[model samples]
Target: MSPAVPIPEDVREEVLSLAREGVPRNEITRRTGVSTASVSRICGGPDGVSFDRSATAAAVQARVVDLKAARIGLAASVLDDVQLARQRMHGAEDNRAFLDGAKAVAALAGTHVRLVAVDKDDSSDTEAAKSMLGKLAQALGVAAGEDADQAEDGGVA
Candidate 1:
């Protein structure tokens, strides 16, 4: 048999992290420049670490909260734009300018409405994510207060 090739520490860690995040073995191999057999060896069976789904769930929840905040901010900006467009439409000096301003108002208003529709109170989901994250930290022997503080400060732990 040929001598075994030693994978780099960084590459091995990258494979492990990708696998934990639910990346397919082939995808991890492609991303990390690791061989398929090596990727499989690093991410499968008893010798391999199982996927950390709790981490993924927590990440997704954090992302959702961030997206909601962004949407609310975008909606506010769109509303401001709509107001400006309406003013411009009313003060337009020509038919073409008036039509352009009116179209801008309509488009901005529609965008604002869609953005507002996506903004919601996800307090329950936030709480659940916090709870799950705390549990995961506990399982990993980490201090819960540290992560809790991070969560309260709007950072994902």
Candidate 2:
């Protein structure tokens, strides 16, 4: 019989890296010149090998999604607070509080968009957020970009 095919270690590593990067098995096989069976064997075997860079990128993307969701929720909460404060406003101080809450809502909205961009790793989201934030800032008559920066810096904006 002819000799058995042996998978090279470098090719195995490349396949594992591609897989971790969300590349499909067949794609990895094509890119790395490895069989799909070998790629599966390396990535799914009991040895538990991993491609750390791609795994970490995936994790960061997941966290970005979670953060964006939290930011949207927070924006909704701020809107409610603004409405309540507006209803209870008795004077200029209360009006200021309402404005501040509005600013908070805008900031959170910007953050939500930014997180979405980061998660997708796409410039399109960034451009969309910028355009949306500009319109929102104009409608709210507040400095949303500054507010977003402050919120990100203070961890509570």
Candidate 3:
């Protein structure tokens, strides 16, 4: 058998840091240039460290917060577009201008509707928010893994 390679302490610590931040093991391996086996061993091997789930929960919450901010900014931009379209329509001096402005307003309104829609099955952000909620619950010890799964299915958990 080949001799085992010894990973430096700093590298192992980096691996643990990434895991605590909710980074996947494969991604940690890729980013740190470490072997997958080494990364896994550092993360949760028999002698490895058990990290605080709260760090992961915090990371997920941050992502959700950032996503919400981006959506708000986009909604504002769409509203501005709609307002411009309305002004153009009102100030139109000819039939063609009015028609173009009307079309712009219709398209902007549709985009705004889509941005604000919260259909769970069709919205990826809804799913991400749900996942963040479950992770937070788990971190807070409010629900075990199976209980969280049941809660997602609409059963009491």
Best by TM-score: 3
Residues 96-152, candidate 1, lDDT per residue (tens digit)? 999999999999999997788566467886899899999997876656677888999
Deviation (Å) of 140 in candidate 1:
64
TM-score of each: 0.47, 0.30, 0.51
lDDT of candidate 2 at residue 72, scale 0 to 100: 66
What is the TM-score (0 to 1) of candidate 2?
A: 0.30
lDDT of 2: 0.70
Name model 1 segments beyond 4 Å from true.
Answer: 1-43, 46-51, 119-157
Ranking 2 against 3 by lDDT, winner: 3
lDDT of 3 at 66: 89
Which is superior by TM-score, 1 or 2?
Answer: 1
- Which ranges in model 3 have alpha carbons more than 4 Å from their true place? 1-36, 118-157
User: How would you encode candidate 2's per-residue C-alpha lDDT over 1-157 as one tens digit per residue?
Assistant: 9886888878777776777777877778789888867777899876565443676689999997788788667656755665554454433366677676566656655655554454365578689999999898796756666678889899555
Query: lDDT at 111 for candidate 3?
Result: 90
Instruction: Give the whole-model CA lDDT for all candidates, comma-separated.
Output: 0.84, 0.70, 0.83
Question: Which of the predicted structures, 1 or 2, would earn the higher lDDT when compared with the native?
Answer: 1
- The alpha-carbon lDDT assigned to residue 136 of candidate 3 equals 90
